[model samples]
Target: MSILAIKHGIWKVAGEEVRQVKQVTLDSEFELEEIIQSNPAILQDNWLIIGRQVMTVYNTYIDLLAIDNNGSIIIIELKKHKTNREVVAQGLDYASWVKTLSPSQISTIYDDYVSRYYENQNTLEEEYYEKFRIQLEEESINNSHQIVIVASEMDSSTERIVEYLSDSLIPINVIFFTVFEENSTKFISRAWMIDPQETLENATNSVRDKEPWNGEYYVSFGDENNRSWIDALKYGFISGGGGEWYSRTLNQLSVGDRVWVNIPKVGYVGVGTVADTAKKADEVFFNDIDGEKKSIYKLSKNAKYHEEYLEDGINAEYIVKVNWLKAMTENNAASEIGFFGNQNTVCKPRASKWVHTVNRLKEIWQIK
Candidate 1:
């Protein structure tokens, strides 16, 4: 993508009158590596770089190592003057090593990296909770991994190969970064070879050689303060808000989809069929005490919801209607050992734990 500057009511190159901004060549791939090391968000907003130039069993160094909120490792291998095929192969090789890593081994790797890179640091578990606000599951770490090939550009053959690997559920992708220079300033733009969301979906499917998805979704209902679980249970709707990220996943719920809602630290509280797609807080209505349809935001008992609704100018509360198969208050919620949980507002989980959880909940809730 080209970067253009609008100046004096005319679109032109950032630095020049009529010429477009020119792409600049990095002196070395290490320069690019350092940039990403400083801020991995340029590649993925949710990723935390755990190791830089991490060494493998074969004695070769990986360009970078990162972990996402889902506890999946990311193998980032820079092209770095290597041929496209070579970089792809290297990334795969590193992934092979990464998949073999146990939770303890991963912690050791992080300890080594921090000792070498930072003056002081918390344990990976602490840092992970601080960064993602969710406890890291050691057993779940590295259940799946992704290979990332970073390059300035990819040839047609490289692109085709990447596409084929992605199509086959290999969880591999290429990121192309272009550097532009103008007026002694440098700018970087990144583009993914395949849509990252599609890649993630493929990775989720490929995880643990799992069985097919059971067409059910997991919803984490953590906003009990703003949107009361009692209110939701009475009103026949699930709501999320506070930010776009918190509410965006609600879009995945459509009419007739099966959803199992968990109350984060509480437990599984409800299983229901989605009755309607998501709507804004002001647009969603439910029967009030007098049996009159009233906007959920105007309900006095849900004062926190109304407060957040009025204050969240950009990302207002969104609610999805649900027809309850079975619902319960938090006091009556059900949970046991090994129940699947995630930080995402909504997720189509492919883990074996998810299947087991759903089956167990069915038995507990007496759902046929």
Candidate 2:
């Protein structure tokens, strides 16, 4: 898409209106490359630049390589003019090589890159853990990779090729960056030809090689000091806090949905069905052993603080009532290596890792 800038100027004659449109140009491809390399977040957030002009076994070079928050590798190729017909094939070639890179090899690439260009001396392992908020395992890294084609414009054939690849569940997309100039000021805007998140979901589902979703969700019960697994089990609920960023996603869980609960840094603690949609803690009620329904604040002393935040508004801890099918204490929480646990409080994860985590939990808990 083209970026147009409208100019308003004094008319040469009365009652005459004149509008001028201006176009901006990049003097060289290096300008586009430098801006992206310096600020990768402009393309997407939480992306750690792994390498640039990185050479492969075939003696070809990749424009840029990055890793995202989900520990997936990103291959970014840029073009100043129309994307070439061979760009798609070149991207696939780089991806083929990238898929075989072990975690150590990826780290070495990042380390060498930093030593040559960056000021900080942090290792890739440290940055990976920091960016993703989880430790790195060699086998777990690069389970899937994505291709991003960035350019000023793309020909119809190139667009069709990319769309065809994506339709086949390949994680590839084109992002167009348009430039505009007015009064010696420059502006750049971005647009994605295909929805990136949708492509990612398609890619994730394709990689899992699993059936369609069974309508169950995986929810993490976070901030133990504010919500306890014991209390959640006793009250038949799950909770989240630390503001709307953490708690807002809880709204995605609806009544009648199945939920598998996990405690971060621990393991899967319980599996349950949602009995009620999410609400502020004070509004949450659960049936006690005596068959009496009471607000969770009365059942758990720690939950009382959630009531205080009710008046504070928006920052209050949110609760979703659950009908526990089976549960274990934090000490006995079932865990295995490579178990899936996202930092989000609630999510409908379709990744194979989530499926594996649930299968393992079922076997450990002996759920029929």
Candidate 3:
């Protein structure tokens, strides 16, 4: 693929334009690694860096190792002077060993890495919870792993291999990062050999093997400081941040859909049926004990603040009404060492961990 930039000139050359596109080489693989290390968010929002230059029992080194919000491991390999086949083989070799790692062993690896590179930072367990907003347990870690090959350029043979592997339902991919320089300004662009979301769906479907989706969904209530869980439970609703990025997922729920509610740092607190789809907070109303209906703002102080904030129109809280069937205070939230929770405010989870979480919650709440 070719990248081009159009340069605008002054009045003397009003109708003329200059196209300058220069391919730039990174000073070294170390520099490329430093750029990715400083901002793993560039790869994806869900990825949390575990360590750089991780070592395996086989005595080979992994370029970078990370974990996504769903507790799946991500192994990233950078291509320097090696042939495409060699780099791909090396990544696969690391993944073979990674797949065998038990959760406890993975944590140990992360701990050792932290001791070496981040001595003053929190322990691996603490950092895991802080980054993902959910507790990490040995059994819940590394259910599956993904392999990412990073290179400045990919040859046709490498691209073909990547496509074959991804189409075969293997969780492997290639991400090409091109550095370009124009007039002393530098820019980096990225492209994936296979669409990221499509690859994930294919991998997920292969794993599911035709298993039907459970009718339930998982929802993470926003942090307590912004939206009160007590208010949510008392008023029979759930809310997300005042931005569309946070609240748009709520649109996936419709009236009569059942959802499991979780509080970050806490656990699964309630199971409820959607009474209505998402709406602006100011538009929602709840019935009072006196049997009179009042706008949510009039009932909950938090709702009043949300309403006040929504007046600006830029960041307005969004709410989804729910009819709580089983509810508990944060102190009694239902969670075990292996229960599943995600950073997403609303998600329809189909992973085995989600199944385990729902089954356990059923026993705890005694719901049919």
- Each candidate structure's TM-score, on Cα atoms with residue i matched to residue i, is 0.82, 0.71, 0.68
lDDT of 2 by residue, 124-157 (tens): 7787877655666665567678988887677778
> Global lDDT of each model?
0.81, 0.74, 0.76
Give lDDT tens digits, candidate 1, residues 74-162.
98889987998999888888888898999999998899888988987889998898887778987668877899888877778977888
Query: How many clashes show up per model?
Result: 0, 0, 0
Over 285-359, each residue of candidate 3 has an lDDT whose tens digit, in order, gives 888999998867677775343555767544678889999999988888887888876656776666777777898
The prediction achieving the highest TM-score against the true structure is: 1
lDDT of 2: 0.74
Clashing pairs in 3: none
- For model 2, give the 10-residue run with minimal summed lDDT: 1-10
Off by over 4 Å in 1: 1-19, 223-228, 239-247, 279-318
